[model samples]
Target: MSVAVIGMIAGMALGFAGYFGGFGAFLLVAALGAVGFVVGRFLEGDLDPGEFFRPRDDRRR
Candidate 1:
């Protein structure tokens, strides 16, 4: 499926969770999804942990 479709599904799931389980559930699901994505990228050798914490030149004044 396309990214938009996948995002729409995820958004619907999260909306239901928030409606039935409250704000905490929504936050928990979002955080878990983020962590899972990072882990998957790491496992696939596409993520560099060090780069995440390093300062970027674009951020400097």
Candidate 2:
């Protein structure tokens, strides 16, 4: 599946969610989608959890 197809499906899902499930459901789906994307990236080893939580070593001397 291409990125465009994934985006289209996601858009359609959000549209259906907004049209039928209302704004709250739309937000919930969007948030969950974002979390899922991140988790997927982590699972694929394309994302580094430490990148987000690790403290910067560039502290001013």
Candidate 3:
């Protein structure tokens, strides 16, 4: 399936979880989904573990 479809499905899942469960459950699902996506990218060799720990140059004077 396309990314859009997958995204839609995930949104629906989150909505159902929130409706049937509660706000806490919605947050739980969203957080877990993010972690799962990160892990999947790692496993697929698309993301480097080092990048997560690496610092950025967002600081300014």
Q: What is the number of backbone collisions in each predicted candidate, taken in the order shown?
A: 0, 0, 0
Task: Locate the minimum summed-lDDT window of 10 residues in model 1.
Answer: 52-61
Candidate 2 per-residue lDDT, tens place, 1-61, comes to 9999999999999999999999999999999999999999999999998889766795665
On a 0 to 100 scale, what is the lDDT of residue 60 in model 3?
59
Model 3 error, position 3 (Å): 0.6
Clashing pairs in 1: none
**lDDT values, one for every candidate:** 0.88, 0.94, 0.92
User: Per-residue alpha-carbon lDDT of model 3 for 1-61, expressed as tens digits?
Assistant: 8999989989998999899999999999999999998999999999998887766975656
Clashing residue pairs in candidate 2 are none
When superposed on Cα atoms, how far off is each prediction in RMSD? 3.2, 2.0, 3.2
The alpha-carbon lDDT assigned to residue 48 of candidate 2 equals 93
TM-score per candidate, chains pooled? 0.73, 0.86, 0.87
lDDT of 1 by residue, 1-61 (tens): 8989978988998898899999999999888888987898999999998888888764766
Supply candidate 2's per-residue lDDT for 15: 95
